[model samples]
Target: MDKKKRVIFLVDMESFYASVEIASNPELVGKPVVVCGDPEKRHGITLAANPLAKKAGVKTAMPLWEVKSVCPQAQFVRPHMGKYIEASLQITEILYEFTDQVEPFSIDEQFMDVTASQSLFGSPQHMAKMIQKRIWDEVGVRARVGIGENKIQAKMACDRFAKKNLEGIFELNSTNYMKKTASLAVDELFGVGSRMKRNLYKIGIYTIGDLAKRPLEEMKKRWGVNGHILWLSAHGIDYSPVKNDSTELQKGVGNSITLPRDYIYKEDIQVVLLELADEVCRRVRALHKRGRTISLSFRGADFNHPTGFHRQTTIPFATSDTIEVYQASLQLLEHFWDRQPVRSIGLSLDQLEDDREIQLDLFSHPIKKLQLGKTMDEIRERYGKTAIFRASSLLSSGLLFDRATKIGGHEA
Candidate 1:
């Protein structure tokens, strides 16, 4: 028997944060609106903007003042993370009603394996409309959905092609994938980033068609396994599953931030490291997992390597305590620091295992610190993360509260 062609839908919320704002206040509909961080404190970066503002060249991450200059009539609003998260949950629930294989790619995007639902629901194209209509009817947020035979094609189609179409839905398969994507720039592919694009350009591979024609073995030899993956992605050959289980999907729990400004002092760097470690460990614990390896990464203000230098160290036992992870990360940072003005930092917990048991130390255990961390987690979960923050959060360079209100480094 031939393998069943998978039907995947990459459902992305259209201008999600702004849409939610419009949904809440119908008067804002069809108007140019921009969601951003605090504008007064110089942290006001454009997080999302409606199509009206986008048409006027209002781009995300541009300074709010510049956005105002571009579209003076645009209405700027602060992000309400709680509202967006609630809407996201509602969207997820609606997707679940259609299929059990809905995998949330981000707060505003989901990959749904609807192959099994074609018989019960109509065709994949029909299902996309149904899903979009339901989300708009129920949550009042518009969604752009792309349908394809696999995840990669679905994502690329949604991001590149579907978003440009008026219907907000598109379908691509083996037959038309090449014609649709071949001549596009290599950077437009799902997995291709700026560095990869530059490297590909150096090798005379500036287009998807160029990448598709490269010999896989030579590409792999040149860019290692990642190169081969990129080459395959260019040809729309992804076979990765849409993982629904949170535990199965996460290889690590991590977070990184490009600071609002560069940190020139070691104290400021330490503050950010501790805050990042706290977040990573809290997430690891929330998932009921612990990791033996803790990694720290940072980059200088120089934008040469946006990905940055990352280093990890393995401890004797698995743990999710923020202090332990922070201490481990501190060692990595100390060893790896090149003394350039640090601009960003990241922390991660890998080598994961179920946090089911803890082995007692031969001589002593840091029971007090473990208990304190657990207490803080409970307080934060109940009252809000900002309710009980560390003293370091008081530092001018700290971004604990700012980060708490954002998702993926933008207004949530």
Candidate 2:
């Protein structure tokens, strides 16, 4: 309608990890490639690779042994977070030349809303081509661009075209979405992935057309929160505001650490748990909020088993005092920990709101006074984070102490 007023664009880098690897060594361009963790690591898996490796049936998240079998000639590269961050920042700067409404969805993908600036740059097709060229020239990376009326449509169109190896740009609306996407697997939808498609298949909706034609009420009956999202996406409706602001402000606060090694010692776990509780409270207070619930998560070295334990005891009073909060979390851990050797540990305090409520107490602990908290916070802020760490957190100087942490990853 009237030249598609809500013009949204999705730019996705192809084979991100592999592309960065080859960018450094052009000699590796045409080789089957895999970026994986240490092959000998107990559960390490491939993270990403080039089209050549994908064609040979090598895939990300596959065990290293399986990946090697798939593409024996494949070259493996370790992850370089520093390089990826620099490239992502550079690509974002290039996109800002066209509009400030750019949102980085991940390290390799972004959403841009140019609805207001289309006339300034010409039609959507011309805008996409110019943006793609700018990215290639400035970031030394190739990207596929998709134009639609909103974020969901643009992202799905990008995935659709990228899989077909077509030109870098794809434009779609309600009319062409189904026909253009008919041959593509529902699992290939930008947000569907494989697990989501499996769940949706149980409801007899196997394609974009199937989802688009289904009634909203029927969709909600089974999928709950996710159902509404899929239905709205089928109709190409995404009203989320593009993010253009800083991501520095803390919303929910938490802290965690890995043990030097697997530990079944009750005293050792209790020490790390107390230290993590203190760290979590510090972060929560720094944000000027009181928390009502504590979430505890931990893992063992054999990570096929991960345990998440959450405790929602109403804070006797909403307070950021570490001792009080840590006591509550200790009770939760005792209830959940089965005495297994744990490799990782974490604690979270949420259900946060403004810390406006004041607790009335005739005899409060003197150390829990407001002055002491403020004094400690200032000293840490000014001197350094390490200026004051709990004795329990004292471990090896190097990051080797956190080796057990990768077991749980960020599910903590």
Candidate 3:
């Protein structure tokens, strides 16, 4: 919170996916819009809702059918993640115009250190307004800005206070930090989750002020090192540096979809698995990476004992081949399925490793298969994703066409 420390700014794009949808199609402006998954395929969870939809009680992660019930007049649009990512990248470029210390927190949020650049661009508030204006003018999206001495304070202030104000800027510093945040709930702090919150309440620490004032020894006794960190954060103390790089190495790649109706037939589920594996493999190849393990998870339609099954299988070699991942997932599905009607299906690739290492076998090397996968990737990337498709995808139950141009089960 000291003025001498580096200044941090947390910028958040407002209703990002929905906003991008609106910007792309100006006719959607001023309408209550909710960006969701592909409705035709029965993947209909709300991913993001615009302000008008939010005011009508539509919420993110709510079922699309439920959203209609809450706000019948709301327009449902499929998400375009590719477009959103492009806009985010443009915004990142704009931020770098001001400072080199820009760390992208997510697709819609960034942390920027303008300490060294403040002299070049007036005060932090001025820089925040300039960035907000530039994003609006150039990218057709609005951003909220939070200014503080460190990342934690800037992020918390942005989420908790900045978005609600007209100026869309909030500053938290050592002088007025406690006074401004004393009445806030303990869980409202950035890093505190539900479990930690319950523990805090059990110890009579119900507010940020209470956590800030707790004895260090008592906190350490309760939560060890994390407890000490929590106390410091509660007092508006954070020293983490904002890295300049924006590229985040993906830890894994996967996809999941909720069926339009209960999938009663195993073959129908197999078709869906193939489609998901196609998308997942495409992503793995896009990153030039592969994994040794494939995981399959599904949710049942039964309400009585709604718990579903999840299982993983490890293969001998890493692969980004669609059929290989699908075969592995198929075997795990047969082993774990309870024969109950399935309402949802998910596939994930983990135990990730670089694609550079290829193990040789006596019978034949997998070099040919790898080349084939790479060739398919190149073809797909050159044209559209739907330009090339597996013959199995044209089957009666396949969702390949429905999902090819989509991201996270929504339209791209």
Best model per TM-score: 1
Q: Could you tell me the TM-score of candidate 1? A: 0.85
- lDDT for each of the candidates? 0.86, 0.72, 0.86
Q: What is the C-alpha lDDT profile of model 1 across 1-412, one tens digit per residue?
A: 1258899999999899999999999788778999987765545778889899899999998888799899999998888878888999999999999999989888899999988888899988889999999999999988999888999999988998889999999998988999999999999998788988888999899899999998999889998999889889989999999989857667788888778777878888899988988888888887878889988888777665554587889999888888889899889878988767876677889988877676576543645555677788899889988988889999887899877766555555
Instruction: Encode model 3's per-residue lDDT on 253-350: one tens digit a residue.
Output: 87998777889888999999988898888778767678888999999875457868988999998888888899999999889898889988999998
Query: By TM-score, how accurate is candidate 2?
Result: 0.73
Point out where model 2 deviates above 4 Å: 1-4, 38-43, 182-199, 221-225, 246-332, 337-388, 395-412
Which regions of candidate 1 deviate over 4 angstroms?
1-3, 256-264, 292-318, 332-346, 350-353, 356-372, 383-412
lDDT of 2 by residue, 179-271 (tens): 777555567666686888988788787887777788999878877878888778776778876676523223456765555567777777777
Off by over 4 Å in 3: 1-4, 24-28, 37-39, 174-183, 191-240, 291-295, 302-306, 309-336, 350-371, 386-391
